[model samples]
Target: MPKRNTGRRHSVSADQIQKYLQEWFDLDNKAKYNKRFKRYLNYRDILTILFDRFPDLKTAYELKEKYIFFNRNTSLEEAEKGLAGLILEFGDSGIEEYHEFYNLLINWNKEIINSFTIINSRRINNSFIESRNNQIERLIYNAYGYTNSKRAKNRIMYCLNKKDSYTM
Candidate 1:
């Protein structure tokens, strides 16, 4: 019988967890699904829609200038707050669907703000997390076949261990 490794223990800041969750959300099939067409939104269409809806506004442009001038050192909270304000200002419709969408956008903005706070204060680098993700993908490819639950557990263990051993 092959012995199962219990896996390494590691600590991750809440920001890192939130970032991972956000990436998972972005990659999820359900999130990409377009109910209207019964199809998934491809990357190009997603970018187009986002750009159309949130076109370059004067305030956002100014923020970008400030960010660039300051060498991209703006606080995440400030950036998120500005984004939430812009979305609320431009997308606010009294209609139910639009209202729900706006609220969801605001919630995401808040999540980003919180995540940035945790990440900036932490002692971890994002490259470590990304490398762990790559490792998990390789493992999945190598395994060929495994229960979904088992794969998920293995991926999580790999991420934790990678984060623990990585320094940056």
Candidate 2:
């Protein structure tokens, strides 16, 4: 018989769980499903997880505010410093462990910020293109809302080839 591969499943850390909750909330707010109630359910899940993780109201509020502030205005380096400071203040670990946690926090922060920046930049460009496409669609609909397929194809071809005809 062949030996079984017995690798353990990787466990998610509390910090990662918190970050995932934030991302879930951001995505859920913009998504529409069968009904409007789906977003509320997602919101409730986020709240439940947060409350379970940090039962103390004060600590939870502080953590929420810190995350929001950093997410909105602070850079990745600043956020990493804030996280490291919090860990140093509250964690009951030795120096080596603390250092490890600090390094992890910094790396995670950098990764999140870099990913967010790239995604956000793409979203901005996509939004602009969507807006322009909407305008083009409206114009086409107004001019030939019920035209035959062949005529519509001709119109699109003319629109595309118009600019190329006048190249200097």
Candidate 3:
């Protein structure tokens, strides 16, 4: 889907579609559908309405959800098989946008599969590093422009390294 809302054309924005699908996935267990809504029934109704109005949106959402499911639940051994199935589904989806995502997965297939590894019951992933990078990027942006790389690095390290005051 396009980035803009495109209200008159009955097209949803990228953000809106992301919200809907993210709620549908409920990976974090903190999704709106889990807390505010009574059950899947309500979200199902909303999705039904959207799907009826824009069939392609439904296809795209389902296609994305399948990958989310596969990524979260599939074992390392099953990763290749599951990804192959997803690749076929993407090809069949007939939505051109999915091809780019499929290509990304293909390019990173080895790393993606390796990420399924678990150590001490924890999944091996780069979430912490990614979040830190995002925070540092935000700090840089808020500064309007950092002229000195060393100063920016020091500021980010200071912010990141400070101990939390809250007691557990």
lDDT of 2 by residue, 12-97 (tens): 99999999888866634643342534553455456566677756643545554655666567554465666556555434333343
- Order of all candidates by lDDT, from best down to worst? 3, 1, 2
Candidate order by TM-score, decreasing, is: 3, 1, 2
For residue 23, what is the lDDT in candidate 1? 71
lDDT of 1 by residue, 78-138 (tens): 6675666656653643344445555665667655455445444662236787977776766
Question: Best lDDT goes to which candidate?
Answer: 3
Give candidate 2 misplaced runs (Cα > 4 Å): 1-55, 86-107, 116-168
Question: Which candidate's TM-score is highest?
Answer: 3
TM-score of 3: 0.59
- lDDT per model vs. reference: 0.57, 0.55, 0.78
lDDT of 2: 0.55
TM-score of each: 0.32, 0.26, 0.59
TM-score winner, 1 or 3: 3
- Global CA lDDT computed for model 3: 0.78
Candidate 3 local lDDT, 87-147, one digit each (tens): 8888888898888887887888788888888888987988899989878777776687899
